[model samples]
Target: MAEHRRLFFALWPDEALRQQIAAISATADWPRGARRVPAAHLHLTLVFLGDVPAERVDAVRSVAASLRVAPFELSLAGCGHFPRAEVGWLGCVDAPPALFALNTGLRQRLRTQGFALRGESFRPHVTLARGLREPPVLPDYPPLHWPVSEYVLVESRRGRAPAYTVIGAWSLAPVSD
Candidate 1:
């Protein structure tokens, strides 16, 4: 059997933003048995690549390298829950178009590279907590403005504590007017 690594592409936030997100999460009324996502693990996933064979890592990197998206401000303004997934999340009220462009471009390119992606429609969100029995009504908060400048390839290690390590990153280009 080939060795596979669990990986995904995501927007890793800086320390300040990470702390802010954590603080907001701390204030939420999570349901019993809810597991709050750790501060260090807070990220907005662009595409979940799942498990990829070790040899195919280079192909994934090449796909990311070819993407050129402009930096955009993302306003995380609301909270919601995915009942089926049993997770609560933070989402943008009005997502910037650049975000969609980048996601679509990456998915298309990855498919062309022979990677099979999930068929679900893109719903960009930051998972705040998991393992909820029923969705909680999250407290309303002011919009958290996030300046997205880069995307990264992350490796997820599951064990005593789930951890994510960023193996590669690509900077977004200037906004085209």
Candidate 2:
């Protein structure tokens, strides 16, 4: 049997933004079946490339390395629910062109190289909680500022606590303030 690894590409948050998300989650009137995501595991997935042979990791890394993205500022606007998915999420109400462009480039490369990607249209969100019986009423939240400087390829491993690993990362070109 061949060994394969489950992977996805995502934007991991800095500590400052992580804390703000944690604060927001702490105050929610969570539904009985819902479980809040751990702050440490918070991330916005760009592309979910299910299982791949272990040897194909470099191909994934090459796609990441070829991106020419610049840093962009994103503000966490509000929360919403995916009814079928039973997921409550925080999302940027505004989808900046930079974020769209980056997603396009990265996914295009993956597709050109024959990798299968999820068919859903890209929606920028960080899942806040899961297993909800129904959508909870999300109250207004102070916007959390996100500084997008890099994207990483992460491996999802099942374990106690957060089960994710940063296999590789590439920085977006820095723009001077």
Best by TM-score: 1
List model 2 lDDT by residue over 44-100, tens digit each: 988889898998899999998888878898888788888888999888868778888
- lDDT against the true structure, each candidate: 0.90, 0.87
Clashes of each: 0, 0
TM-score (all chains, Cα) for each model: 0.95, 0.93
Q: Any idea what lDDT model 2 has? A: 0.87
For model 1, the local distance difference test gives: 0.90
Give the 10-residue window scoring lowest on summed lDDT in candidate 2.
133-142
Per-residue accuracy of model 1 over 1-177 as CA lDDT, tens digit each: 999999999999899989988989999899999999999999999998899999999999999999888899999878888888899999976898999998998899999999999865889899999997787666777889999999999999999898899999999997556
